[model samples]
Target: MTTLLRNCRPMGGTAADLLIEGEVITAIGAGLPAPEGATLLDGQGMLALPAFVEGHTHLDKSRWGMGWWVNEVGPRLIDRIDTERATRRGGFDPATQSARLAREFLARGTTRIRSFADVDTEIGTAHSDALVALREALRGTMDIQVVAFPQSGLLVRPGTLELLDQALRNGADIVGGLDPSGIDRDPKGHLDAVFGLSEKHGKPLDIHLHEPGELGAFALELTIERTLALGMQGQVVLSHAFCLGDVARAPALYAALAEAGIAVATTAPPSRAVPSVRAMRAAGGRIFAGNDGIRDTWTPYNMPDMLQRAMLVGLKNEFRRDDEIAWALATVTDWAAEGCGFAAYGLAVGARADLVLVEAETVAEAVVATPPRRLVLSHGRVVARDGVLAS
Candidate 1:
């Protein structure tokens, strides 16, 4: 199938007609004639940008369709885990839940999502199964990457590592781990097991590092050490390394992270200072952003729109200038694509036809306003439009 996206402004450039044949973009030029039988998606001079690549999300714990819950207590990280297990042990279907969120995300111009599926002894491969099922179900609409995450500490739980292995065998794409020193209390042992699984399965790795201050920095150091030792340069990602921003040695840590080739993800948490995008990029680090939970057992707030998340990231990071805001937007788009393992993502000839047509005229305005996505195309097919499924 061929689709012609006409009169679309290329970010800050003039209007162009983008022709997509099947999945890859074939040509992009102004006033190009549309071929016969080709579908015409008139953008009407809307700003066109690459669709968002969600580098972090948890579908297993998503509370989109289920009733809402406001955690009234301390609601610490551990508390959320307990709440999730207690509230989600039974009567939870990941396929249906993830499918709904996929639609919502696509409508908001997110075409690819790397989601964490908790893999512990208690839940076993149940979560992985849900995500695997959803991945298959939403193959064309949304590219789903399921990470076999041991939400529970790997060494703390005796049989958890095996469960992680099972999750990977069961179809999870990336091998995931939690805070090494903070949660497991043994950074070496935790990372050894985590890296062992990735090596054994020949899969990439991403770990959640919500550890505070020096602890978080230590965890990242250990992770970087293992990543370098294993030579898994670009294949490893550290999500929520908020500790890098909290500690005084933040600049040094950022430089180290860049040298070690370890990517970091930030959700722009409300508590502390996060990594400086400029510094990280300057030191050769990739920074991506994703909404961790969507009205899940962990937090009350949830949004599938990566654009809105980009805005949050920009605002929380104190990005006020145009270039800074543009870079902030890339945190969910181009900058994120590399971290999420997307090889062909963007609005150019030979790139994957994953683009969004927004109502704003420029990229900065689009990030600020995030007016509803006019049209979202995934694999050269219309997936969503105007914040809903495209007809």
Candidate 2:
């Protein structure tokens, strides 16, 4: 299929016509003659950008445990585990639930998602299964990356590591771990076992750490140490290393992480971590953002808007210039992907023809307002297009 996207501004440049053939972008420039047999898409006054990539999420607990709570509690990830378990076991179907969520994300312009599925046996492993099914079902509409995450301590939750192994065997792309310090208090040993298993299975890893305190930092350090020692070939993503910001170890830690070839995934609005991110980026560290939760038992807030999250990230980080904020918002889905060693998916020629058209003049305006994605295309195919087609 050939498609021509015309009159759209991208990366703060003059509007151009993007020519896509099959799944690859064949050309990108202004006023090129329409290729033979190409569908033309008018893009007047629209901001065209690479499709949103959600690098961190937990579909197992999304939109659950809403209300019926006394007070807003502390660190809701743990509470989410219990609530999610009951819901799944109480005859809530996975296929139906995941399909609904996938549609919601697509409707919001999110075409790529890297979601964590809990592997702890206590949680019954239903989430992992649902995610696997969701990935296959939404293959054409969305690119989904499923990580087999041990939400609880791998050591503490006997057979949990084995469950992770099972999930990988069943088609999980990444191995995951969470809160090494909170889990076993033996960060080194736990990471050893977890990464060891991941390495043995030849799977990449994504560790979730909230950075509780000095203890959490210690845990993250051990994780970095083991990943380097293993000489892993794939990316090692550390999500929410907020402690690097809180524990006053931004400079040194960021240097260490960059040197070791690790990327930090700060999904939430890091009100306390912008200086840390700036310093880290200066010191060669990479930072990417994602919408971590959406109406999940994990958070009272249910809206999963990565664009809005980027605006928050920019506002909290003090990017005075609108273009600077635009750059920040584009980081998570583009430059960050390159920094972390993934294939490019942008508007340039030879890139995947995956893009979104929004109702805004500039990327900054789009981030703040988050106007509905007017058109969404994946692999040069029209996965979604809002509004009626002209006669």
TM-score of each: 0.97, 0.91
In the order shown, the candidates' Cα RMSDs to the true structure are 1.3, 3.0
TM-score of candidate 2 versus the correct structure, residues matched by position: 0.91
lDDT of each: 0.86, 0.72
- Stretches of candidate 1 exceeding 4 Å from the true structure: none
**lDDT, model 1:** 0.86
Model 2: colliding residue pairs: 63-295, 63-296, 295-302
Q: Give a tens-digit lDDT track for model 2, residues 1-391.
A: 8888888887556889888888888988889789889999898848888877777777656644334433344556566566656555656555565666666667666777788887777755667888998899877667788888887668887888778888888888888888887766667767887787787788888888875667767876777787678886236888888777677765777787887778788765643453345766788877777777666545555355567767767776667688677756865578555544456577788988878888887777887777877887777876777622111
Worst 10 residues of 1 by lDDT: 68-77
* Residue 244 Cα positional deviation in candidate 1, in Å, after optimal superposition: 0.7
Error of 2 at 212 (Å): 2.3
